[model samples]
Target chain A: MTSGIRPKRDEETVIAGSCDSENPRRVDGLQLLGEYRGAAYEEPRFLVYRPDGQAVLLTPLLYRVLTHLDGRHSLASVAERVSADHDRAIGPDGVRYLVEQKLEPLGLAVLGAPVEQVPTADPLLSLSARGVLFPARMVRTIARLFAPLHLPAVVAATLGTLLALDLWMFTSGQADAAIRTTVGDPAAMLVGVGLLLVSTLFHECGHAAGCHYGGARPGAIGVGLYVVFPVFYTNVTDAYRLNRAGRLRTDLGGIYFNAVFIVVLGCAYLTSGYAPLLAAAVLVHGQIIQQLMPTLRMDGYYIVADLVGVPNLFGLIGPIVAGLARRGRRGGRHAWRAEINLRPFARRVVIAWVLLVIPFLAGGLAVMLLRAPTYIGIAWRSTAERWTAVEQAFTHGQVATILIDTFATLMLWLPWVGLGFLLARVLQRAVRAGIRAVNRRR
Target chain B: MVEDMTVLEREHVEFLPSREALGGLVNVNIVVPVNLAIAVLGSAALACQNAVGIIR
Candidate 1:
C-alpha cells in the first residue's frame, strides 16, 4: 500500500484504507472505524474509526452484517450467512472481494485468503424502535380507511361551506350558550355529542379530498403522539412531490372543507335552533382555532411548510434548535444572538426567554406520557359503562349515550397517537427517498 | 479487524465496483402521525370538554 508517503503541509492527510498501527489495542471483538468520501454518504449517517485511526462510513447493509458477525462465525461461515441473508451466494471470490473492498478498508478483514473483517449495515427502520403504539395491522387498516378520496368538487364545496359555518359560529358565539348548558335534555346532549364527532370526520375528509384535488396520493391516515401531544395525522407525503401550488392546496384543504361543513351546519342550527346543530357548529369552529394556532403543529404548520418550501418544517425546527444550542455552548455569538429561523419567520429574539424549546419539548413529552393511561382509562370506563347500560336493556337505554361518547373519545384519541407515528414515519421515508434519488442522479 | 484495503488489486475490490440500481431513499419520519395525533387529541380534548360539562 502506498507506504513512506510524506504528508502534505496544509491538507488534513486523508490516509485512505490505512490502519493506525501505533494506537493502543481495543477489546478482541471491537476493532476500528472506516472513512469514505463524504459525498458518498448522506446525512443521518454514522462514522466509525478503528482504534488504529482509519475511519469508515458504515453503509446500512454493511452495518447490519457486522453486528451479526460475532466470533461464533468463521470467515467462510460469516460469508455464507451474509450471502444467505442477502439472498445471494458468497463464494470464495465474493468473500475475498468483500474483504478487500469494504472489510479491509475498515481494518476488519485481511487482503489474502481467509479474510475475517465483517461489515455491518445501518439499522432498519423498526416500528418498535420508534415506539409505534398500535399493531401494524391496525395501523394499516385505519390508514387505508382514512386514505385520501378523489371526490367531486361538489363534495369539496360541501366541506368548504361547513368550514365557513364553523367560522361564523366561533365569531358570532351563538352556539356557546347551547353547548354550555348544564341542565340539558339527556337525548339532546347525546345527539349534540354525535354531531360533534361527525364534524371531525368531515374535517379529516377535507384533508384527504384536498390531497386528492392537489394531485397527490394520500397514504394511510391514523393517530399518534407528536412528542407528547396526542394527535391524528393524514399521509400527504405524495404532495411533497407536487409543485408549490399543489402543496398549498393540500395544506389548506382541510380548513376549506371544514368551512363548508360549518356553513351547512350553521344554517341548520340557525333555522331549527337545535342544540345538537349548535354543538356541531361549535365543534367545527373549534377546528379553525386549533388549526390556526401557529405555536402548535397543525394544518397551519403545513401551510407554513408549503409557503417556505420546507415540507418538513417541524422536523427542521428541532435541528435548528440543536444547532443554536451547540453554538451557544461553544460561545458562538451567532447562536447567542437569538436569531431564530423558523420556516415562515426570520427574527432575533430570546429563544430561551421565550421558553420555546423547553416548553415545546416538555409539552411533547407530556403528551406521550399521557397517551397510554388516558387511553386505557377511557377504554375501561367506556366499555364497563356501555356494557352496564346494555345489561339494563329494557329498563333504560340511557347508557347508549355514555357508550357513544366513550367510543367517540377513543376513536378520536387513539388515532391521534397512532397516526402521529405513522405520518412521521411514512412521510419521512418518502422525503428521504426523494432526497436519495436526487442525490443519486446528481 | 483491520485490513489493508488500498493494497487490494482491482479484482479483489469487486464489492465496491459492482453497480446496482438504487431505489429512492424514503426518510420515514413520524411527523404526520405526530401532527395528526395532536390535532385529533386536541379536538377530542375539546370535544370532551363539552361532554363532561367542563366548559359548561
Candidate 2:
C-alpha cells in the first residue's frame, strides 16, 4: 500500500530501488506465482514483492513480460517471445525500459546490468523484523487441513450458529451479564481476553483456509509489528489468482473464522456457564465489526476491493486524486486514464471509494490530531490506573487481576505510542518530500 | 482484465498482498477499540468488584 514513485536519489535500497541494466532475471528463487497455463488467465495479475513487504500490481501486458523471466532469456529474446505470444510488438528496448523503470525500481525483477546481489526474500517474501510462528510448509498444511470449512454448507451453518448466539446473548441479557461477570471476576476477565486474543489469531487461520479452498497456496503464519503493536497475520498473497468469487472468499475468510471462534466461545459459555467466555464472544463481535470497516486496511477494505475486482484500491488514491486536481485545469480532462487502468464500472467504484475514504479518513485523522491532547490524557490516565491495578493485584497475589490489568494497561498505552510513531513517520515523510521537491526544482 | 488491448502500457500494476503475504497483521480490532474498551471494561470490572471489595 505504498506509492510506487521513488525519489531520484542514487540510494541503494529497494524501498523503490531499480537497476539500470541487466537481464530480466526473476530475482533468484523468486516465489512469484504464475497462473496455470492450461487456460485460467487471459490476463492474471502478478504479485512482485519489494524489499519492503509491499508489492506492485502489474497490468496483464507487463505480467506477460514478467512471466517470461527465466534469467536466461535476454531482454530482446523476452521481447520477441512476448510480442509473438500476445501479438504485440514490445521490442527489447520496451522490455528493458519496463524492467528498468517499472519492475526494477520496485525490486520485483533485477536489471543488475551491473546488478549487485539479487534481492530474493533470500528465502521468503517477508515483513521487516518478522518472527515466523508457522513456516510456509506448516501454513500450507494448516490451510489444507482446514480447507473443508470453506465448503458452502459448512459456512452457512457456522454463520447461522453465530447469528443464534448473538440473538440469544443480547435478547436474554446474557451479553450484558457476561460483560459484568467478566469485569467483576479477574479470572473471568483474564480468560475472556485470552480467548479473544486466540480468536484473533484463529481469524488469520480462516484466511489461510479460505485461500487453500480457493485453489491458492498460502504462505507462512507469523506475528509482525504493525504500527508498533503485535499483529497476527497469514500470508494469502496467492489468493489474487482466484476469480472475484475466490478473492471474496479469501477476503471474508477471517470474519468467517471469527464466527467459528464465536461458536466455540458460545459452546464453552453454554457448557461451563462461564460468563467470561460469553464476554469474549462479545468482544469477538466487536472485532468483527472493526474488521468489516472498509475504511481501514483491514478485511472490509479487501472485501470491497475484491468485490470490485480491483486488487489495490489504496494504490489508486493517489492517481485519482491527482487526476482530479489536474482536471480542474485546462486540457487535463483525460489525465485520469494515464493513472487509472480499470474498466469503466471498476473505475467508477474506485473513484467513489476514494471520494468517501479521503474525507472520512482525513476527518478522523484531523479530529484525532486536534484532540490529541485529550486522547493522550485519557490514554495516559487509563494506562496509569491499569498499571496501578496490576501492581495492587501483584501485591495481593491476585494472579488473574494482575494479568488482566497488565494487558489492559498495554492496550491503553500502545495506541498513543503508535500514534506518536505515526506522527513522527508522517513528519519524516513530509520533510523528505519537501527536500525532494526542492531538489527537483533546482 | 486483459492487457489493455488498445495500448501496450509500459507499466504493470504489481499486486501487493491482497492479504498479508508476510504474516502478523494484528487485526485493527485491537488497534481502534482498545483505546475505548479498556476504560469501559475496566470500569465494569471496578463496578463488579465493588461487591468483593478488593481486599485480597
Candidate 3:
C-alpha cells in the first residue's frame, strides 16, 4: 500500500518526460523496514527487508524509488515518481541500473527469469558456528531472568565488589599461594578449568541478555572452532539493527558477566577462605584480558568496531594495507583514497588498529612457532606416559586409576587434535586454490 | 503486513554523532589502553614472581 502521499501533477510531468511508457516493473516481496542515520555516513539510511530473511541499507533516493515499485508503475514511471517527490531529475536509465544492479543482488526484485549461478570462490574461509544449541525462545527466557541484573543498583554493587576484591588481593599473599597450589594439584586444576568453562557459558548468556535488554532479539548460542581453539559463540547479529550503545552492550556483556562472577567468588573467599575459588577468579580475569586483545575478533575488536560504527572491520584490513602501500609508492604527497566503506574518521581508526594489530599478531605467532616443537614434544611424552599408566591400571583392574589416567591422556592429546585441525584446514585451502587455478587455465 | 508496518513505525531513529559513537571512541582510546597496560604489568609481575621461585 502506498503512503497516500503524491507529488504535484506539474512535477510528475517534468520527471516522466518522454520515458513513462515502458513496462512497469514491481519489487517482489520487498518491504521498507525502517531508517537510521549512521555515524559513519552523512545520509540517513533505510533498511529494506527481503522475504528471504536478509536486509540491506539503501539511500533515501533509492528507497523513494523502491516505494513506487508497486508493479503498477514502470521503471520510467517509478523514476518519475521519485524525481517528482524529491524535486530532482532521476532518469529512467538510473532507475533501470539501480533495479538491475542493486536490488537484484539483494533478491528484492524480479528483473526477469533468474540468471544462471556463477561458481565463484571466496578468498577467505570463515569458520562458521556448528548449530544453534540454545534457540531464540530459550535465550529470550533466560535473558529476561537476568535482565534485572543490568539495573543501576547491580552496577553499583559490581563496582563495590571490584574495589573490595582488589583491596583483598593487594593486602594478602593468599591469592598467589592459592594459584600455585591450584597449578600443582591436578585435581584442583581440573575443577578450576570446569569452573572457567561454566563462567564462559555465563559470559555468552550475558551477551544475549544485553541484546534482549536493548530490544533486539537474541538468536542461538553455539560453539565453533575459532582458529584452533573451540570457543563458545552467541548469535547476536540482530543487534546490528540496534544503535551503537545497544551493540556495545552486547559486545561487553560477556566481560560484564565475568566481573559479576568475580564478585561472587570474591565474596565467597572473604567468607570461607577457600583460595581455589579466588584462583579461579584470577583465571577468569586472565580470560577477560585475553578476550580484550584486539589482534583477533574478540570482545576488544568488536568494541573498537562498535565504537567506530563499522561492521566487519577485520575484512577491511587488506584494502587499507593496500591503500597504505599505494600511498607509499606514490611518494606520500597526494592523498590516497581506497574504496573502503567507512567514514573518514573510521578509516583512520581502522588504519591505526591494523598497524597496531599486525606487529602484535606477528610477534605472538613468531613466539608460538619458535616454541611449537618443544610444546609438541612435551605433549607427546606426557600423553604416552599417561596412556601407559592407563594401560597398567586397566590390566590391574584399578577402575579409579584407569579413569584418572584416561582423562589425563585425553587432556595431553587435546593440543595435538587442535594442531591436526589447523593442518587440515590449511591443506583444504591449498587444494581448493590449486583446483581453482587449474579451472581458470582450462 | 499491518503488524510489520506498526513495528517499523515504533522503531527509534537516532541521527549520527550519537552518544554511542562518542562513548565507543572513549572506550577504544582510554579503556582499552588502560586494560592493555594492566595486562602488561600483570604479566611482568608474574614473570618476576616465577623467576624468584615465589610461584613454584
lDDT of 1 by residue, A1-442 (tens): 1111112333232222222331111223343232222121121123344332233334433543454445445556666666666543444444555545655544454333332333222111212113323343453454345434434566566666655665776688777776755114445655665565555545555565566666545554444444323344555544544566766666666666566666776788789887677775666566666675444456765665455433333333444566666764655655333323231232222233234545654565466446646655555564454444334432554454445445444443443454456557656667877987999999
lDDT ranking from best to worst?
Answer: 2, 3, 1
lDDT of 1 by residue, B1-56 (tens): 21333322321111111000010001111223334433433344435444644333
Which 10-residue window of candidate 3 chain A scores lowest in summed lDDT? A1-10
lDDT of 1 at A189: 57
DockQ of each: 0.05, 0.29, 0.04
Error of 1 at B12 (Å): 30
Q: After superposition, how far is residue B8 of candidate 3 from its true place, in Å?
A: 28
Q: TM-scores of all models?
A: 0.45, 0.80, 0.72
- Please give, as one word, the docking class of candidate 1: incorrect
**Model 2 chain A: worst 10 consecutive residues (lDDT sum):** A117-126
Q: How accurately is candidate 1 docked according to DockQ?
A: 0.05
Strongest candidate by lDDT: 2
Name model 2 segments beyond 4 Å from true. A1-27, A30-55, A66-80, A90-96, A103-112, A117-132, A224-230, A328-331, B1-18, B21-38
Taking chain B only, the TM-score of every model is 0.35, 0.37, 0.37
